[model samples]
Target: MRGSFRIEGHAIASEDGMIAAANGLMPDSLKFPSDQKLYEQALDQAAVIANGRLSYEGQLNSPRRKRLVLTRSVSGLAPDPKNPNARLWNPAGESLEAACAALGVTGGEIAVVGGPFVFSLFLGIGYDAFHLSHAPGVRLPGGVPVFHEQGSGRSPEDVLAAAGLKPGPVQRLDDGVTMVEWTRAA
Candidate 1:
């Protein structure tokens, strides 16, 4: 999951915890530079669990769009009878386990791009790996925390460790950003 890290570990672009403000737009100051190619390549052939907004616009527009599965939680929503690429998940009506099974999402890398709630949901289930990116020199003071349960005084890394993931080497990305991968400890 990709999150913006500030010195204080805040996640959202602002205190409102809105990725995009009332206008549905993020300010330039909050936008961190990223490798577009890497992001595109990762989405190829991957099952993407994203919110309704992103499912329709962002991921669906990719060139590897055909290989991607769009899963969202919307009441009364379902994959088109003829289309195997979309899945509608009702968290209130179904278990995450059941949703995954119904989507036929089994035995491969599952990318979880999220808001804090989604990240917290998966934390309980467990993650085989987590790629945490830190953008130095940027701070979203009073912004949302990447892990909703965080700021009870525990750092995100501490939360991951508590969940049994072991940190891997740090990989530096462009623009003063760095990422560290954490794998479930054997």
Candidate 2:
């Protein structure tokens, strides 16, 4: 609440691998076009990071957020070409602790936002805080699960607590929809 922190969450139906499916990683389904705006914001955020609009660089140049995008198809367009961000290293070679240190965000708030797989990586690497939305879950028969085999090694909440995040008030939107906010454990 005082400084920068790592952020992680999911969207059930992103075409670009950033969105989640209808049934989330948890086990229940959300009540589908409801979270459309939220996904739009996610794309907007991705654009800002991709366009080098975040963080200070003597003149506010680009995303120095140490981004590690997780995607099955790595042939997409490059977001930040100035070397502000690094390509994802999948399950290994991209340690969160090391990245945090390199980005000078240690002891400060570190953010991690993406699909379930990425959250699992962060969880394995010890990241806290999960700000997720409860949307109407949809089922994709051949869809991928939120956490991968390697990601499933640890509990996300455990990593979050160790990393300084804890459960907070749940903000439910409309009637059944809700936005759950978590913070670093103190």
Question: In the order shown, what is each candidate's alpha-carbon RMSD?
Answer: 7.0, 9.0
| Local distance difference test values of all predictions, in order | 0.51, 0.42
Error at 161, model 1, angstroms: 1.7
Clash totals for all candidate models: 0, 26
Residue-level lDDT tens digits of model 1 in 125-156: 56777767665555554555556666666667
Candidate 2 residue 132 C-alpha distance from true site, Å: 2.1
How much does candidate 1 score in TM-score? Answer: 0.67
Model 2, which residues run further than 4 Å from truth?
1-66, 70-84, 87-91, 100-107, 149-167, 174-176, 182-186
Which ten-residue region of model 2 has the weakest summed lDDT?
A: 47-56
True lDDT of residue 69, candidate 1: 30
After superposing candidate 1, which stretches have Cα over 4 Å from the reference? Answer: 1-27, 30-36, 50-84, 101-104
